[model samples]
Target: MIEQFFPELKRYAEDFVASYGYTAIFLISFTESIIQPIPPYPFIVSAPFFKLNVYMAGIVALLGNLLGALAAYYSASFLGETFVKRLLGEKLYLKGESLFNKYGFFAVLIGEPYKLVCWLSGIFKMPPLVFLIASFIARSIRIGAFVFFGNFLEKFIS
Candidate 1:
């Protein structure tokens, strides 16, 4: 489905990962976490196909994702609750608020994909160091899985 809609993007991701190596993975990971719709999974998964070192790729990607997440976190922090409330509206914002209030740190760690969790964490003013730690752990696991699957796919094909 993605290929059908965005063949050029797919090709660009492939070519970028192939040519730029870990740097590509880092940049993609960063962009994806911040605002880009394309996830970094494809880049991580295709690293082996490009004959790039999967471990390095994963680490660099993790770093990028952390940086991006931090950017999101800080951006939301700067924007404050009024902006988020206006953006999300009353009902949705309340739901997010309820979840974050209940789950706290785990909300950010577990719901990394939601992206809103990161923003909400900042909006609610979760401690910066705590947010960083939880985000790092979550992103590490996620990136590891993508790298593992990429290597697994490579070996399967070979």
Candidate 2:
């Protein structure tokens, strides 16, 4: 099928990750952290397969994801509770608020390492400094995971 008509497509996928690697990684991390639908960790993991391309992929993922988190945070902060309640529905708004209070930025710490959690932490009105610190800690953990699992990740698939 694909290979028969365009055998090079497969090879392209490999180079594609390397060639446009930074842009794609950043887009996935940053956008997904906001209202977009991509996940962050997978891209970082996917990048290591190319070996030389891996470090750049990881960096792109981190910056993009952090940018996405900032977007989510600002969106939530400026939107206000009343607006959030109207958009998210009272039930979710209440739950989010509770979670925000219960975990503080640490809650985001758990999820932000992935992407969406970073923004959600911001939205819940967690302290800015806390969010920043927690995000950094979580991201560091995630980055470390990438490095530790680099070899294994080459063949990772879901």
Q: Which candidate is the best by TM-score?
A: 1
Clash pairs detected, candidate 2: 30-64
Off by over 4 Å in 1: 1-8, 86-91, 112-114
Q: Show how many residue pairs clash in every candidate, following the order shown.
A: 0, 1
Residue-level lDDT of model 1, residues 1-158, one tens digit each, is 66888889878887888888888888888877766666777777877788876777888988898888888788888988888787667887798889888999898788745467777888889999998898888888888998899878878877
Model 2, span 43-153: residue lDDT tens:
566665444456666677777767777877787678765665676677765766677678776577765224345545656666777787877778767865874565466
lDDT against the true structure, per candidate, is 0.81, 0.64
For model 1, state the Cα shift of residue 84 in Å: 3.0
Error of 2 at 35 (Å): 1.8
Consecutive 10-residue window with the lowest summed lDDT within model 2: 111-120
Which candidate number maximizes lDDT?
1
TM-score between candidate 2 and the true structure: 0.71
